[model samples]
Target chain A: AQTVTQSQPEMSVQEAETVTLSCTYDTSESDYYLFWYKQPPSRQMILVIRQEAYKQQNATENRFSVNFQKAAKSFSLKISDSQLGDAAMYFCALVVGGSRLTFGEGTQLTVNP
Target chain B: SAVISQKPSRDICQRGTSLTIQCQVDSQVTMMFWYRQQPGQSLTLIATANQGSEATYESGFVIDKFPISRPNLTFSTLTVSNMSPEDSSIYLCSVEAGGGETQYFGPGTRLLVL
Candidate 1:
């Protein structure tokens, strides 16, 4: 079974600063995908970024980037220039082709202004 | 991008009653998933609904307790039967988009059983 683990339960970042949330997974499959989802108070889960296992380069979307280390099974989300709107619960998820997605415990991010 | 909408965004149902939540997607999708998010907890997969087939439930979930229906490629419904306090959680519907692994989630339906 594939499992995702998020070590940080809570994190805070000052406005205009950056914060990184750690995530690790256990998967034997050589091909997979990683994603970061942000759930705001509205309870709408939004896709933050995505990374493909075969890609060596990290994925970047605006201020959101992922440091994906496939060998170590580590996929961390980096939020740069944090803004107040970034406050939410962030979840790391893993997906194998045509299979259900496994999600991390999630990290509650607070943007301190 | 696919846009999804869930009916009865939030509801307060009494125990022993069943509440059916509807999920509608703007575009057809091959895979649709239902998830439950307990208070202060991460999302847990309840079942996977595919068109023209019975829903595949995950471990610890069953059809009697949470019956699901996928009538078409772009519509599905999940019913919480015999609701209890434990069933009071946010139920979400998600669909695969762009033929990639990424999933787009709908605005969840919050159920509060009393």
Candidate 2:
């Protein structure tokens, strides 16, 4: 079974600063997908960004980017120019093909203004 | 992106009772999944609801306890039978987007057993 791990239970970053949330996974499959999801107080889970295992280039979406090390099985999310709205519970998820996703325990991110 | 909605956003029920949560997707999808998130915990897969067929439940979940129905591609229902305090959690429904590995989740139905 594939498993995702987010070592940081909680993280804090000052507004306009940068913060990185670490994530690691264990998978035997060579082809898979990794994603970072944010759940705010509204309870709506939104996709932040995604990376395909076969792709060597990291995925970047505006202020969000991932440092995906395929060999290390590490996928970290970096949030730059953070804003107050960036505060939320961030989760790292993994899925091989169209199968079900395995999620990490999640890291509570707090943007200090 | 797909818009997913879950009916009865929240409900408080007595123990031993049952509650059925409905999930509706704006667009038709091939697969629908049910997940449970306990208080301050991560999401756990309950089952995969396939259209016109029975749902495939994961380990620790059974059809008798968490019965699911996927009458069509865009609609599904999950019934928590013989509910107990342990069943008090947020129930969510998700679907794969554009045949991709990424999934979109509903707002979730918060169930409270009293």
Q: Among these predicted structures, which one has the highest DockQ?
A: 1
- Tens-digit lDDT track of model 1 for A1-113: 89999999999999999999999999999999999999999999999999999999999999999999999999999999999999999999999988999999999999999
Predicted structure with the largest TM-score when compared to the true one? 1
Model 1 residue B60 lDDT score? 100
- Candidate 2 stretches greater than 4 Å from native: none
Model 1 chain B weakest lDDT span, ten residues long: B95-104
What DockQ, on C-alphas, does every prediction get? 0.88, 0.77
True contacts kept of 1: 0.83
TM-score of the A chain in candidate 1: the value is 0.99
lDDT (10s digit) by residue, model 2, range B33-107:
999999899899999998988899999999999999999999999999999999999999999885447899999
Q: How far out, in Å, is residue A61 in model 1?
A: 0.2
Model 2, position B54: C-alpha lDDT score = 86
